[model samples]
Target: MARVVVDVMLKSEILDPQGKAVERAADRLGYSTIASVRQGKRFELQVDGPVDDAALASIHELAESLLANTVIEDFTVRVEDN
Candidate 1:
């Protein structure tokens, strides 16, 4: 089987309250070297056959249409090495 990964993240301009909260918590926990944080979503898909260009294209389309909100988020699709 082949695997594909889709990573979805909010746009830089959008506010990420959850990420900010985590960052603050980390600072309180004494992780001073830590910088900012942004949260995102990851989706892993398993395919029954070899990964090809057509499959990649389809996955990209799916990412754009269902995996992410294009107005506020961006997504990347890639094949995962087994």
Candidate 2:
């Protein structure tokens, strides 16, 4: 089996209300060193077979299409060795 990780996040141009809220809360809690915050998602996928070029390509496509909003977000996918 192979493990794949997908990280999805909002583009820099997009405003993140949730992240800002978290940042504010953290600041109020005395974590003043935090300059900013951005929220994102991580997905772990376990493939039942070998991870090859085609599999990687497919995973990339999946991340671009389903796992992230290309118009406002960016994403990266990588295979993790077990």
Candidate 3:
């Protein structure tokens, strides 16, 4: 089996309300050493065959089209050896 990992994060220019809230909560909980937090999402896809360049390219397309919003978010996709 092979694994593909997709990480999605909001664009730096976009406002992240959820991240800000978590940061504030962390500060109130005595985690003030942390400067900020940017929340994001991860998607792990399991493929039945060997991971190759073609699979990586397909995963990249999937991540861009379905997993992340290109307008407001950026995504990185990587394949993990199984």
Say which candidate scores most in lDDT.
2
Instruction: Show model 3 residue runs off by greater than 4 Å.
Output: none
> How well is each residue in 1-82 modelled by candidate 3, as lDDT tens digits?
7788899999999999999999999999999799999999999999977778888888898988999999999999887666
Per-residue lDDT for 2-70 in model 2, tens only?
Answer: 899999999999999999999999999999999999999999999878899999999999998899989
Cα deviation of 46, candidate 2, in Å: 0.6
TM-score of each: 0.95, 0.95, 0.95
**What Cα-based lDDT does every candidate model obtain?**
0.92, 0.94, 0.92
How many clashes show up per model?
A: 0, 0, 0
lDDT of 3 at 61: 89
lDDT of 1 by residue, 1-82 (tens): 9999999999999999999999999999999998998999999999877788888888898999899999999998888888
Tell me the spans in candidate 2 whose CA falls farther than 4 Å from its real position. Answer: none
TM-score computed on alpha carbons, candidate 2? 0.95
